[model samples]
Target: MDSSRGTRIRRRVTLFLLLLVASSLVGTSRAREAQPLPTAAAGGGSRRAPERHGLSLDFYAKTCPAVDQIVASVTAARYKDFPAAGPAVLRLFHHDCFVEGCDASILIAPTAAGAAASAAPTVERDMEENKNLPQEAFDTVELAKAAVESKCPGVVSCADVLALAARDYVQQAGGPYYPVKKGRKDSKVSLAGKVRGSLPRSNSTVDELLRVFAGKGLGTADLVALSGAHTVGFAHCVHVLGRIYDFRGTRRPDPLMDARLVKALRMSCPSSGGSARVVVPFDVSTPFQFDHAYYANLQARLGLLGSDQALSQDPRTRAMAQELAGNKTRFFQAFVASMDRMGSIRIKKGRKGEIRKVCSQHLLAV
Candidate 1:
């Protein structure tokens, strides 16, 4: 063959090989994408590790088949009488999980014996961070526990009960209903000291909030999605005082906050001599409903808590905040995924935990 003709033939061969290799790679990529995602049982869909803690959707299938129904009934009754029970129970679950890994330690009450053992004995409930967790939450859990105990006696764990109750309340309040994996045990220890820095504060910056959530293996998206729980909750005036008044001691409201929100907040949360018990709904537009309105409020600078509003202002989380604001269905899906991950943090198994007969008292005390 002539030199030019020979070179042309070589180029054709090289191009053919490259095209073949590219086709193979595309096929593999499509195959991988077509595979079904791992479900909760497989534990492969989430960022967190698989389900190795013995938790399952039907943990009580044979032992106490009616556990879910019982807890749901009690929570629904309480919610009907007091709509606040929904948010109260939801906050209780978050506080419980964050401090001691969803062990229901927050439900433990201080006792004379415990007080005698320490100079100043305090359970998780007495911690400054948990002081505002509302009596309705504790009461709702206790009621559910009592009903469960009557049926299954020692088969149900208070931690599992609280988890189920939290889900029930969230669904009752117009939020997505997600399946809760059970098999969690109540923590034997409930020291108030462990709760000091476990929860995110009202005025926490985005970085501070991110650190707290990250410590539990959650990312920014999870943090923003979980914050949507604020949609159905209320914040005490004290939590928003600084934002509406002298933000960061600027002697003025937070510039990021909308002027209309500032004026409305001032009416409810006065700068001075305001009743400490006064509270305002987290989402002014739809206070009692669990929806994407919380994100929309953040977009509008109407977020009740600094940490919540910071999600919209911060570059890392702003996109997610805006995305969730525009799509309620996406927000619900993200919230469920985050809740599943959060509920699985640092769970206890084997002999590290127990099933409390009464949620408010340890088994030994009972």
Candidate 2:
């Protein structure tokens, strides 16, 4: 063909490809905006079934059985022997992953900030396994997997196990009906620094949280709902004392807050900067339930994180939080909806991703 003829053909092909890409992008955007919930199995129709035909049940069964065993063992131990720690552990996983699909990424250490980065690496003992909380949830999950390996023989992924545990944890605590998709391979690469960067910190601003979620393609409603996890956990002196004592004048507690309560909180959580005595659980009175107590706490200006407080200030979220706090069914409904949004955040998938074999470490060689 002549040069002009060849160039014309190439231009046509490029135009066709651009149109195709544009069409696909438009379809995806509409699907995401609709964000419809999946109906129950009994509501069968033209809609697709929850389980995909090519997906393997053997893989799910192999992956999930261990989660059942772990839940059973922990419940028995908590109720029969160490009852105090049961509720705390149950609430930790619920609080940590409720917003972002239960990644179990919260357990990782904080990436050292800047120049002090080269100092000796040490885990902050109080933050992870503080007396207010328990380390058994993490340890027991692994142990349960070990037991499953003895029986089923190395078929489950820790990622699936954690996801299962997170669902069960919420359900056991009187939360929403969890809908899960199993088969997440455990990540073998445990980059603590990356995990730290991914999670919201005690002082994170609403803008910071918004930017983080936006990067994952999530919106404001999803961000607020996830902050609802504040209903089930506590904050160490390290996490909340800054707002009480070292507060930068402007971010001080709202005037609407009860003076006595604020004074007591300040006294209890002194400005010692991460002191043991000053630590206060986020949901002080009810640290184990998955209800609207967190929202109620925010109304009283008792929010632990800066991001948590931002919800009450936003017009869109304040009403939702208040309404949910008063209505159990509404709370559950919103929880599920928000959780679905959170889970839809961008994740590594397809041929570009690896099926990790370990939950806390890097993927094993395929």
Candidate 3:
């Protein structure tokens, strides 16, 4: 072979080898990026590791880089047009976390098969505790999920999106901005029977609230800070009527309730239940702002629900509420910390749980 022919052959071979190596590297990176999160055992799905860990903020730094910003923008816009959406979304996140440890179980609607099992209950949303929850809260989650799906396809879980959405809603409502840990997996099952004792009741006592929240890694301060979210949401009249008009068969307003607030409550919620569905803000003073006003209301005996009043009735919880009411800055800091802890509850990280394609349904059978 001529020298020129040999040189050309050598160059061609070297170029081909380099291209092959580059292509291989690219393929390996794509595989890493596209790795599937764990789900209910399937034919070849990722397996759940024996140990479960909490999520991290940068869990999707490479795979879904804009997930946090996407959720923020979507929720902020919705909240701007509809101010009431902020508190509603926050409540939804709390409800979801209280049951099944922030696994997106609350977002699930009944499937055709589950609904057909009329003889036995199926979905969790049908439970009494969840039935009266504002549908707008669930709708806000839907918006956040839709936004995340559009940006990252199926990489982010609906559960994580909900956590982020709750943070965003709080911030938009003039509250503190909190960092949400990511990497939650959607639950494959949501049963009505499981919802009964998992959630906090409107009439729950301070002890009951503390016990339930403590079981999920929250302390007294966390409970107080979280309850401050009531600064923006409204309570159904029926939920507060007993505290205002009749207390434990007293047939009169609770002695702890303020007389003026009781009068206002009666005007909106008649004893005849004529307007049982009417709603009233938890924070009578600053209903639109997310601040320490809730604690202030508790101090003034203007709290709307029996549970809210219970906080001030107990010495330990009352001390926490008083401190939060005295310092808005401290309240914001504690609230942000508590919410972070709440979001970390029993998360399915690494290779457990699925990144649900649709937030409302399980990817695999339970």
RMSD to truth, every model: 19.5, 19.9, 21.5
Pick the winner on TM-score between candidates 2 and 3: 3
* Model 1 weakest lDDT span, ten residues long: 25-34
The per-model lDDT (C-alpha) reads 0.79, 0.49, 0.73
Which regions of candidate 1 are displaced past 4 Å? 1-52, 112-120
What is candidate 1's lDDT per residue for 1-366, written digit by digit as tens?
A: 124532543353344334434434111100111122123222112344423486899889999999999999998888776777789899999999888688888899866665475785678877778878888789889999999999999989999999999999899989998899999988989998888888999999887886777667677767888899998877888998888889888999989877766776776678999888767777766667887888877766677788888888888777777777777787898889889988988888879999999999888888
The positional error of residue 364 in candidate 1, measured at the CA in angstroms, is 0.3
The segments of candidate 2 whose C-alpha lies over 4 angstroms from its true place after superposition are 1-134, 249-257, 340-366
> Candidates sorted by lDDT, descending order?
1, 3, 2
Counting only residues 3 or more apart in sequence or on different chains, how many pairs clash (N, Cα, C under 3 Å) in candidate 1?
Answer: 1
lDDT-better candidate, 1 vs 2: 1
Ordered list by TM-score, greatest first = 1, 3, 2
Task: Flag clash pairs in model 3.
Answer: 38-353
- What is residue 297's positional error in candidate 1, in angstroms? 1.1
